[model samples]
Target: MVFKTPLLDKPAPGWKQDLPGPNESPSIEPYPPVLSNPPNHVDNVYLELARATVRTRGVGVWLTFLMFSLAIVALLSLIAYILKEGTMPPPIPGIALLMGFIAALWGGVFIWRMDVDPPRDEPIRFNRFRRKVYVYRFHHHGLRPFSRTAWGVRAEVYDWDNLRAEACSVYGPMGSGGLIETVTLAVVKPGTHQVIDRFHFAHEIQQGEMYWAMAQLFMQQGPQALPAFPRPPRDWNNEDVSFNLARRLAPKVQWPAEIDLESRTAS
Candidate 1:
């Protein structure tokens, strides 16, 4: 099934759904607790803000990119050859062509989705200094099917106290027998369990929890309390063709000025 989640102010699902359990801020103790060591955090995105700026590209992006790109080319080629022969599509080839076209359409959509110019990362910044989190997101229209929802870029700010972490898992498309799990920071209404807003945090749970822990530690005790990132950050600034093409065609990380400033300040 395709993955879908309520966006900005859409009422969140009630707790009774079969979805994964709500991973509260530190699962009855989330690993790498507020007092624990950082679990090899690496986000050139930004550890610099008493902040955690994270990427929107989740798991399976690269793999989906490859699969869909190939499907578009191969499927289109098959359609062309069949058309060139001027014969009606046979039973197997006909269904195959239909499936291929759909897959190709989605593949093209994936390419359009990711390959973008700078600032497309939709970076979510958690500023411990200001006790706030600023989300840079492109809110798509949820009324349509999930894949079609790429609407507009907007920045949102929230008080840090109301945010809760939740894990959502969805099956891979075309029955690929794979599971994709992600962590999202849900914004609950002040003093209530009602979630009002949310944004993607980490592609995987453990890493996201670690980032969450580090950010929490920074907010409460300052940056000195957390361990250093395992290595220099890795970002799209390098010369790799994929990176360069992404910069040329689509996504990169650049936070809004107001949020950026407040997130980094001590006062």
Candidate 2:
């Protein structure tokens, strides 16, 4: 028997022509969180924000630690009882000790995992004076004594001039019967439009303002001039808009060319 590949549908010759031109504008509609009522947090000074996931994870870590601590305490009590009660079997103490050890080991592993796999949605800090952006992730262990150093915090820095920003809309079905819209901010490499970081804001009151505030800082453009959500040329894909904006706004950096075969041979 011979195997054959299935044919795929092909676009018409005029498909490109049929698409809306760059100049054409779609029915741009403005959604909630009006420009007038920007979030109070949108100030000219340094800005710090964290994704919702990070907050949720922090709560989860504390809860896990509490549960583990209780288990450890109960195991220790069991071991003590086994030792004092002469009526109990000889192996009771040993079994309790073994279980306690296992619980302790589990607790250690949990702390290690939390430290190494810190939440992805860490806080983002933008310092205007320093011209830098910093993202911070925190790790904590309940067993260890509390100390600032023991927080296991880590930070990553990005230069202000090298950063690019993009906004995209996400839609999903809501249980209430209507669709819910979410806005996402993407920090990207200038010119190339490669995404380095991203975060989301629920598309509700005040969130839009927060997005614009950050975008203004990243673009180094005035807040008024920053691109608004549901950007123009609605026919274009969000990815296309992001790339085009990056190319237009970012300074074009000329990368060094690859060495030729002749140069390699001579070397």
Clashes, model 2: 0
TM-score of 2: 0.35
Q: Give the residue spans of candidate 1 off by over 4 A.
A: 1-107, 115-120, 140-152, 238-244
Q: All candidates: CA RMSD in angstroms?
A: 7.9, 16.8
Candidate 2 Cα misplacement greater than 4 A, ranges: 1-53, 57-81, 84-97, 100-123, 127-131, 136-156, 161-220, 226-267
Worst 10 residues of 2 by lDDT: 13-22
Error of 1 at 18 (Å): 14
Alpha-carbon TM-score of each model against the true structure: 0.58, 0.35
Give the best candidate by TM-score. Answer: 1
Clashes of each: 10, 0
Local distance difference test values of all predictions, in order: 0.52, 0.40
The positional error of residue 264 in candidate 1, measured at the CA in angstroms, is 2.3
